[model samples]
Target: MTTIDVKSRFEAKLLRPAKPGNDTSWAFVVLPRDASEQLPRRGRTTVEGTINGHHFQATLEPDGQLSHWLQVSGELLEAAGTAVGGMVTLELAPVKKEPEPDIPPDFQEALAATPEARKVWNTTTTIARVDWIHWITSAKQLKTRAKRIVDACDMLASGKKQVCCFDQSGYYSKAFRAPEAESF
Candidate 1:
């Protein structure tokens, strides 16, 4: 339950896609490095915070540049009546409970159509489910996403409980990798 409070302006930045051929419309707000360093974890952490007095619950994720940030959804910006460059008062505390992501309807239907996959999905922990959802949704193209959904269902039906060969925490993901220093 560590909490940190800071008053700063919201910084507008585009989150470049980690994978090539992915859409580049992802935008986010940069969290102050000073404040971000106070959190308990360097990776994604469930955070309950307020922006301009509007309460929000979100995950603070690493920005792949040794920094952390929160995604600024259009709803949040509208609710706060603030845009990208507006000054905001922020207060954040780590939430003890992990929040589950909403599964897309198509994905849900795919699981329903596959009983074996549904059984495996039901047995997985909340965090595991979240990771699966994140990986599937990370695909930028509709075709890719649909393919991922089918592949996920097939994998689960085959008794696999997690998304193999993927960095679930995103630490080693292309966007979050440590920069290579120039050789002497």
Candidate 2:
């Protein structure tokens, strides 16, 4: 891990997203194990920094292999003057403040429909909300996601403050991993 309190700088080769038919601009990179260890936590972490000298903020996802991965967006790619297959230098640190998550419409609507759950969700801290979202989106199957939504609502309504027994790191659960890179 990079030295504490000092920004971590490293070079990473960009790669294609795991799925086919993705937009050309959608790419990703896996942070080296050592760099990932510099983070404050093993779970999903929000980071603010620059890629190729262009300012950007994004959340890094746990690779489930005890590493971290980042999805590169089009705007970020353009601003940084890089693309898939490009090796770019990055300087990163955990964002001091958590940014609002882009919640899925389905989850949003579910929260809206359940007054009790909405009450709990609204009162929960943003970090907790992030965890709730991570749990929902981590589902590999649509049916599992749907069930998680229902369960989330139920748990919240019952006054559960966090997702119980969830392996946010994906390390112990083996339920998540960095998506497979597409064939070059």
Candidate 3:
């Protein structure tokens, strides 16, 4: 596919979770696999796009099955004059420079306790930190998450710049996935 094809500009219908939880306010859409395959990577790729002419930026999370999904905030939906179940056009491309990923409190605390790791972390690229955060946070179990934090600290202290053996796309390990939304 051409670069333009990989950019994945297309239309999709907005959807909400069948049963709302803490995220009742958010709507979402899934990208077709073909469109997703055109992106730079399978993991979380930050993109700047317009939703029905309402400009916004977001990081597309891998859908565990080799595709990707995007969450549309209520504010964005309102700005775009779109709503859940509304069809919207999207024009997206990977951002030139990735913004820093939010560090979870537990991971931040762990880093604080390890001075060497904290120093290395401060020096790592924002994109690397993004992947590290994704790898650490994608763990399904609390114990797995805790272990990853400890391991991440050790690796960072040892001067590792990026996560090792992590499947960012979730296709190989099925470690990542799009959030569940209500089906039509």
Candidate 4:
């Protein structure tokens, strides 16, 4: 598959916790607006990349301010032997094919228990399913995640085909503030 390769070094930083109970320790590297614009997609772009020599696959997401950024999970940081506030070199290339996201066990069970939801889930497109799974799994607290699962089942059972008010392409959460707003 053809890919667009970009190599750059960036300083990693932890975004402020989305909510009080959330883990703000998640690290990220911001891509310049020009570089982001050259990417294949505007919202979520599937990618295979290297971070400080550790190979990884991830979705590059927009930061809501027309810039793109990659979320550096704790696992990726550990594999790369890096830490928050550290500088890391990244080599990214857009992947033409993206494998399906694995559904969380709890979510899979919830869907199994609600056949109607599962039916609706089956009818949704892959991107829609991805958004739903991302929404449910992105929760930081167990309680929140559980609630999302329940909510998802309820929504799907009610024939809701897509997650409401979610910007799948934007940053980690819908609550993320733009850099300018964050400076205050």
Candidate 5:
């Protein structure tokens, strides 16, 4: 697989595509020279426009092409008497990366809190941590992340690493108690 890295906060000229917003307009997307495939997955990358002050969502595909979707409306096109596919520069600004959460503190705290959690956290490999981080951070809502964290913690305590333990009944415990553990 061929890979081209686009730096975050860099600009590129539209060559093949004649106008901005053209289906082919992405051919000229100027990535923030520092952009990276390693960038944390977020909803959409956006940047301010020099022409209209509109906030446009920009995306960099794996192939190094750029795509932009209109966020405001038809006002800009009408103002310029240009078509939707008219050439325009889509500026891609670097998104502020969030600081990495300290791992040892979280691991230590979970270990101190529950033995099962400690085992799970300890048994988890580096890849698992990366997956969990990406999953949690990608969530747009705080509540969703919190819920996922709770569930992840519960799973950890139950001696399961993600899908390996999620049963059909959604119950983690194998040792079922009579009335308390029964699910109807």
Candidate 6:
């Protein structure tokens, strides 16, 4: 297993959301693997390879952490390495994320109390609610996290769950609407 020891800290920014239609839009600073080399490339062609079994395409940023796209078909096996005169296969390992907790009863009650909130909540998908709930609960502070929950609930009431403004082409487009609300 090849291990990459990065001594320096790096920051990666999302230049553009990765989507279909666009060939490439992401960018990152490219720094040297060795700290001895001071000269750094502001922008470099992203290295395309596999790590831990997942396919990754990342550009080197001025800082150390490589900004790359992680596409996983199966479990990631190993990290990238400098090899020559042989077949080089990227390895990928499983990325484990903490399981989401059940939705709070008070939160559900609040939504149930408000007509608009209920409408929005009814419109939002289970997956979208799960994502929102996970994001809100993940906050470090309870107050701030509660605020996020309120804010998300407001958005749902406003009818913008998983708000998709445009298609892959950056053009405003239509998508299938969520199922109709049930009637008593």
**Candidate 2, residues 1-184: lDDT per residue as tens digits?**
2232336889999888757364766888899998899887778899887888777878999999888999898888888998889999988898888887888999999999999999999888877888899999989899999999999999999999899989888999998788789777
Which pairs of residues clash in candidate 2, taking residues 3 or more apart in a chain or in different chains? none
Please report, as a residue range, the 10-residue window in candidate 2 with the lowest summed lDDT.
1-10
Q: Give per-residue lDDT, candidate 6, residue 75.
A: 21
Can you give the TM-score per candidate against the true fold? 0.66, 0.88, 0.89, 0.62, 0.33, 0.34
lDDT of 5 by residue, 1-184 (tens): 2122223333233233333343432223323324433344322332333322234333322212222222323454444344433455433343343333345454345457777776787677544554454445444687876666666677778877653432211123321111111111
> Tens-digit lDDT track for model 3 on 50-73?
888777889999998988999888
CA-RMSD of model 6:
18.0
**Model 6, 1-184: lDDT tens per residue?**
3333233333222122233134332221222234213212211222333432334544322222322122222122123222112133333222122223367775776677667877876666654565565455545687877777677667777877753321211112322111122222
- Which is superior by TM-score, 1 or 5? 1
What TM-score does model 3 achieve against the real structure? 0.89
- Candidate 2 has what TM-score? 0.88
Q: Which whole-number lDDT from 0 to 100 does residue 46 have in model 4?
A: 73
Could you say which candidate leads in TM-score? Answer: 3
In the order shown, the candidates' Cα RMSDs to the true structure are 7.0, 3.4, 3.6, 5.6, 16.1, 18.0
For residues 1-184, could you state the per-residue lDDT of candidate 4 as single tens digits?
A: 3234554434444333233236545666777676676666656667787777778889876677666777777788888898766677776766766667788899999999999999999998777787898778767799999999999999999999899977665554544323321221
State each candidate's clash count.
Answer: 1, 0, 0, 0, 17, 25
Instruction: List where candidate 6 sits over 4 angstroms from the true fold.
Output: 1-101, 163-184
